[model samples]
Target: MKYSLFTELKSREVIDLFRSVFSESEGEAEGQVISDFVSSLLATTKPQDLIGCIAEENERVVGCVFFSRFTVPSGQAAFILSPVAVSTEVQGSGIGKELIGYGLDHLRSQDVNLAFTYGDPTYYSKMGFKQISENIVNAPFPLSQPIGWLAQSLDGQEIQAMAGPTQCVDALNDPGLW
Candidate 1:
């Protein structure tokens, strides 16, 4: 049977479980930036903005995702989707999809309209995303992903004017990530 729950970042053991799952993600980068991003986000956001997923089988977390607030030029409300990972052994089990879907539903509940990420739309679009050109600035990643830049608007309204060079959010002001 499949099970999932939404929760906060939580303590060390959960973080460790998340890291193990992340090490298997497609862009697997030694999970160095992911750890830093988690720390930086924890320091930068309110207790409410950081969301995670605990996917379970026999009550053990085997997957997770991180969604936190980011200040777009509008300074209204937006979500930054980073670090979604499933256990290396459970890649085809759909855990990653459930995690992302939960995050999206939570954002919907909060009336959040936008979600941004630098990843393939093929995977993300399945979670209700599409390529967006309104990227005002580059992502904090070292590698450029012009085509990989995408956004998913929860309200069903397209964001044609949302493009611009992005500046780092105070919550994400880690100079290294940028």
Candidate 2:
């Protein structure tokens, strides 16, 4: 598998991959929701704030993930990972993990100070994310699954408590998404 940053030309493929992957895993309705979310993310977010990553095999995109700029009161460079998808056929393989690692490496090189993601703690923990409380760093919206609020400091320093609410990009600002 090869990993690389995605360009606008691959937008449709990336969106389709997420839709199909989520449909298989979470049913059709939820799939459509994720697809729409990705569409909004691609269309509305500024280029500098959105980073798309893809895993390709035989020139076909098999897995994809996105990390968008997130804001914290402390003013450090931060990003939030969301809507990760790996093809159902290749779920057991390490493609998802490697793709995420590639994205994080790219972020680190770009001087991103911290990374946050809302998802299954068991799976995200494997990626070095630890559960963090809202008091430490607030999420943009009230989380239905507080346990899944996870984050990691990309720099060597530990995460410090931020003073106010965290803000995600417009596409992810929906309360229902949390």
Candidate 3:
């Protein structure tokens, strides 16, 4: 398997991968929602504000994840991971973890201060994320699953308490998605 930057692949191909993966696991309707969300993220986010990675085998995309600029009250450079997908056939093969690790490393290299992601705690915990309280860093929207709001410092420092509300890219600002 090969890991590469999202910019190196076609947007349509990645979108289709998400649609197929999500459709198989989360049903067709959810697949479309995530597919459209990814489409918006790719089209609306500025190149510098977005970081994405993909996993490929034999030149075919098998997994993908995106991290878009996340605004925190502390004014530190940050990004949020969302809407990750791996082809159904490749699920549980560690491609998702590897893809995320690659993206996080890339963010660290670029001097990004923090990384946030909203997802299953057990799943993300394996990647070094810890449960973060809203009191420390408020999520942009009221989280439906607050326990899933997680973060980690890329520079090996503790995540300090941040005041005020957080902001995500417009594509990820929808309440329905929270």
Candidate 4:
């Protein structure tokens, strides 16, 4: 397996991978929702505001994840991970974890201070994320699954409580996604 920036692969390829993976896991209607969300993320977000990584095998994208610019009231550099997808055929191969690690490393190198993700805590905890309270750092929207609100400090410092609402890129600003 090879890992690289999401931009390294064709946009359609990444979109299709998400569609396929989500369709298998979450049914077709949800798959289309995620596909459209990814399309908006790619088309609407500024390059600097979006960071992505992909796992490829035999030159075909098999997994993908994205981190979009997140604005915190504290003014620290932050991004949120969302819409991760790994091909159904290779779900147990650890490709998703490695791809997320690659993206987080890229974020660290770029001096990103805080990384947040809304997902399964059990899975993301394996990636070093811990459940964060809204009282500590609020999410952009009211979470449907409050337990899934997770965060990690990329730097050595601990996460400090930030007040006020957070902001995500337009593509991720939708409440339905939260």
- Against the unseen true structure, what C-alpha lDDT does each candidate score? 0.66, 0.95, 0.92, 0.92
**Local accuracy of candidate 3 as per-residue lDDT tens digits, 78-124:** 99999799999889989889999999999999999999999999999
By lDDT, who's the top model here? 2
Task: Write the residue-wise lDDT of candidate 2 on 1-178 in tens digits.
Answer: 9999989999999889989999999999988999999999999999999999999999999999999999999999999999799999999799989999999999999999999999999999998899999999999999999999999999999999977878899999899999
| Model 2 poorest 10 in a row by lDDT | 160-169
Better of 2 and 3 by lDDT: 2
Question: For model 4, which pairs clash?
Answer: none
C-alpha RMSD (angstroms) for model 4: 0.9
All models, RMSD in angstroms: 3.3, 0.6, 0.9, 0.9
Q: Once model 1 is optimally superposed onto the true structure by TM-score, how far is the C-alpha of residue 81 displaced, in angstroms? A: 0.7
List, residue by residue over 25-113, the lDDT tens digit for candidate 4.
98999899999999999999999999989888999989999999999999999999988999999998899889999999999999999
Query: Model 1 over residues 134-163: C-alpha lDDT tens digits?
Result: 444345544355677777777776664644
Is 1 or 2 the stronger prediction by lDDT? Answer: 2
TM-score of each: 0.78, 0.99, 0.98, 0.98
